[model samples]
Target chain A: MPLRTLLQADDVRRAITRMAHELVEHDPDADRLLLLGIPTRGAVLARRLAAEVARIAGREVPVGVLDVTLYRDDLGTQPTRATGRTDVPADVDGATVVLVDDVLFSGRTVRAALDAVTALGRPAVVRLAVLVDRGHRELPIRPDSVGRNLPSAKSERVRVLLTETDGRDEVTIE
Target chain B: MSDHLLSTRDLSRDAAVALLDVAEDMADTQRRTVKKLPTLRGTTVVNLFFEDSTRTRISFEAAAKRLSADVITFSAKGSSVSKGESLQDTAQTLQAMGADGIVIRHQASGAAAVLATSGWTRAAVVNAGDGTHEHPTQALLDAFTIRKRRFGAGSRGRDLAGLDVVIVGDVLHSRVARSNVWLLTTLGATVRLVAPPTLLPTHIESWPVEAGTDLDAAIADGPDVVMMLRVQRERMTEAFFPSAREYAALYGLSAARADRLRADALVMHPGPMNRGLEIAGSVADSPRSTVLEQVENGIAVRMAVLYDVLAGERTA
Candidate 1:
């Protein structure tokens, strides 16, 4: 299929709600749980997730944007990319940090995000969360919470569209 | 962005804005507790300074180090250049030692342009400052500071359009003023230069600025920014002006002149300030002054320039 909608708007909403509930269940205290979203679509998803978690746990969780462009390993080999805003709301010292992203592919972005987080401050724990996890393991990285795991070949392209950024909310593969 | 940053005139509007935007991001990284990035790891940058500028050299070295690049500062005072070593021999030596980038500040005009265009080395070239030619990074940092003050947090992707800026003092020997004139006008800001008649360049009519000898008129116009350029006392071999007191009275941003400016108008000086000659001591240390901010932003702007030139592979 040239274009196929894997997750509709309602499905994406439900996935975020479920992930927020799972996060609340994991950290009921909700004291040191911080959600950091990667830039672009991931930052939007992070805001939505933080709001949901606040509603469920009856406490607001700190949310920040983590742009890993400068920490990437391929900067020297590939074209230099524009950096995004890396705003850590509060200190990450001794806090449980969760990196939120839209899609996880080669795992390199997450690797870079990890490097960026360590540079910011030493966190007590670190976890990964993604809306979609396509199977293409270039590095030893696995998500702690995945909204959907879609098995696809390396040649296919996966896209995550958020209403805040792309005027819609859905997951597509082509 | 080009491989070398020789002049702001070479940068289009979009390219200049992009550089400023990147500098904003670099400034954000600098505010963090850990201010180092691994973007330029394993890359070697040689600060090839032919003139004695400790501040600019330190700023470039700090920018390089913050990006995790190894920096080798080569000052010409005691180096091989003092022994009459030519630029070609020095560049060849740097190339043989595998220099990835060279930030050069020379005493002759077009020195940076020649080094960049010539085939002495394959490294990226950045002109720190040339003989009254252009200091591109200094202009970039000044633009960065102006945009930040004008737009505040909403500074990214924004140009200094519709802003009126008045630059006062020695225009003949100011590379900072030259670079700022070209870059700021390109960014859509209106620039006015005020200096003594002798200090103003003879080709002032050809530039895209309003040049005048009346600092009072420029200040009375209620410009949004008033930038006082440092009067180069050392470069004044002949009589550029009658006396320091006369120059200060005619052109300095004195208390009366500062009082005439708009309350919110920014006061800027690319310093090593002649506290009483070009700008009053109280004016330089005023709340509206951005001298220290300009210095702080210099590292960020230089980091952006270094990253732009050195991060990507050379594309000849």
Candidate 2:
């Protein structure tokens, strides 16, 4: 009996590579481009995207991590995900900020990311990019670029596991 | 102990001092050209504030940002929490969402303590402030402030050993006093509690500290430090003391009373100070005062606290 693979490791790579090229093509001037990874799994995805963007764009873009755990209203008052901090590199002024994350559901994470990004500095324009867009829009948030649009029930949990941290590269609905 | 920092009593003397020392490193961020770090690089920190507080919320926000952690600021003003959702439901929600750390300020004193015990969120729990129970970071910052003013910033990596200190005023309702008593006692500081008979906890004698109701003598004893606590008017309707003016005239750190202490002694109060109540403005702003130092050290103490709880650095 074989194990299940929701979105395999290879599948994630191919989609993000295409997403990276689209990002470069859309922005053109890659100099002002910086990659920000939301914590836990989003950080890994952002690092991958930065690597892919480097191969395609012939440049190693500055990458930063945003941990927006402190902004979630659900913690203690209800249920909440694990949270960290927001780390933007020194040179975000007048740059195009592409915030990256693994999953987009309820759009709260993106909303928090926007709040975190705003605190960093004035990025010329901010963009949202995600690996999976599990459509359950509780807020008016839409990603500028998305890897896969997967539908999930509000009761179900969608977890993104990476080999770097989770010992496997896959997304599972558990 | 689990990785959560729910209170100061949970920390050992070495652990508490290490946290303060790490905070010393975090304080250097203020002197940096770029006031940020990637130390907590891929971590998420959630600020779940059930209570409204501006200075503390903003200070934690600034501290988290300086450490480069993702911060989600959640205030349940008109949110789902107002819908009467259970605390378990809320914590599980954050768990499902993947929160790494949760900084919560609730109206309940043991709320943070309960959350840390509950298997709700796998994230590290840092209590920002809780209902009249304990504010560990505030106490730590108070200690840090005292240390810096008495010894200077270069006195980093030091512990509060052999410091004789007396905390007067309202101890029964002060979370700050509770935290200080625990941490300072652990750090080998000989602590004495001076309060009105009604203002001191009955079980306070269980702790390893001297307790009394004589304020002038506590100061007259020439202790190395005198800490006056604010009389929470809202928390008390009936008089804990006879009158505000009388409390000042009798127990307050007036200029003449202030002159009774050792010339090198320190005076402290955890402000929002009442000018003529527990502390006089002149005494609060005096040369020996560490009130302002407490406010500034609050940032570093909070930074040290957050970093200690979330740094993933541990030793047996």
Candidate 3:
């Protein structure tokens, strides 16, 4: 595993700040922006995005988590540990949805998450955000916002760490 | 553990209802006299039974055939299960040959739960009946029957909110009773468990139902539905009560007890009834008795379940 410091913790915050402003500009009215974090690391980013969106828009944005365990197309290969509970406070019907995931790899997780979110309610539009973008996508998926890009092998892992969960914002190789 | 339908608690509230909804789609196949679909067309559905079941196995076979799925019926006396191959090994073998789903019935509880969630994720698992644990599809059918009977054409979009359900007889070892308790409660119906103290499970408090030992007191509450569970001869052997006649005299739905219920209150039983034990033959045959309707509803409800789990309504 290569110790590549592509983006420092501070650099990641600035990127999020820019991304948050871009999202606000994309939807000017932005009355109720909904954020759904994919399980584990994505949840941390979802909450952070919500806070950042609030700082820029002068209002608290509603955020939640989506557990896509049952929706996984290729199940049983990975340890399907339940990370935490998902809470959808606002009805996603006709709302702009920003689905946050930690790292984009095969794009299957995002695919499953999209299906699960759709069952909750019909979102007007769905967009994806990633902390780190790792290539080799099995699906035609492109992230709308990215904190940084990491070049990696399939066997290696790009683990996302944040102060909300791991007490420090960093990306580690495993 | 052997794979079987033990309880509804094994299912989440969402999954249970989704299974019921799916069963509805399967029921539609009956409209065609041919009664077959192409969903499980090439897949094999094996019914491995450890206990005697006429309607349950047949109902499942009917369900599989309706789905155009291959059916293999296994008997305890004839199969390797009797020769002592572990259920895990057998399930893995079924997986190898491509069994899309395994509909199993066993004498042990929690068998279905273990199989469905266990590492063998290739096949969809349906629990037919497992020991004193659950008969899920049966309960779903009962609910479907109740909904259709009570609400009619408009029952499709409605959820049972205030329906009073009284379950009478042996709650001790009846898997049907166990399944109904959870499913009914999850669906927002008020469930009353009426049985002898010795017949109630130790964890009855954990169940979201009104539990009492007196049948008269339970029905006196005026439940919209009165379901008499089959008091198995198996329970008599365990000494849950003194005698069948005595139990019937005190707890059974006689001509007099049937009058105690609301006139519209539907009488039900997961059948093969000990008529003289938990319920009188007269009450079971009464027009209000939905015992037969339950059987008819069983097919539709099961079809709905098979389709729901496979259709990926919740999973998709």
Per TM-score, the best of the predicted structures is 1
DockQ per model, Cα:
0.68, 0.02, 0.02
How do the candidates rank by lDDT, highest first? Answer: 1, 2, 3
lDDT of 1 by residue, B167-266 (tens): 9999999999999999999999999999888988988888999999888888888999999999987777899988899999999899888988899999
Indicate which candidate wins on DockQ: 1
lDDT of 3 by residue, B25-101 (tens): 44443543335544445557778777779899998888777766799887777678878987788788788877766
Clashing pairs in 3: B5-B127, B6-B133, B6-B134, B22-B304, B22-B308, B23-B303, B23-B304, B23-B305, B24-B304
Candidate 2 per-residue lDDT over residues B1-57, each given as its tens digit: 236777888878877766666666556545544566554667788898888877788
By TM-score rank, best first, the candidates go 1, 2, 3
Task: Classify candidate 3 by CAPRI docking class.
Answer: incorrect
Would you list the clashing residue pairs of candidate 1? Answer: none
List residue ranges in candidate 2 displaced over 4 A. Answer: A1-174, B313-316
Prediction RMSDs, each to the true structure = 1.5, 12.1, 10.6
lDDT of 3 at B26: 44
lDDT of 2 by residue, A96-127 (tens): 99999999999887886776666566889899
TM-score of chain B of each: 0.99, 0.93, 0.91
Model 1 residue A5 CA deviation in Å = 2.8
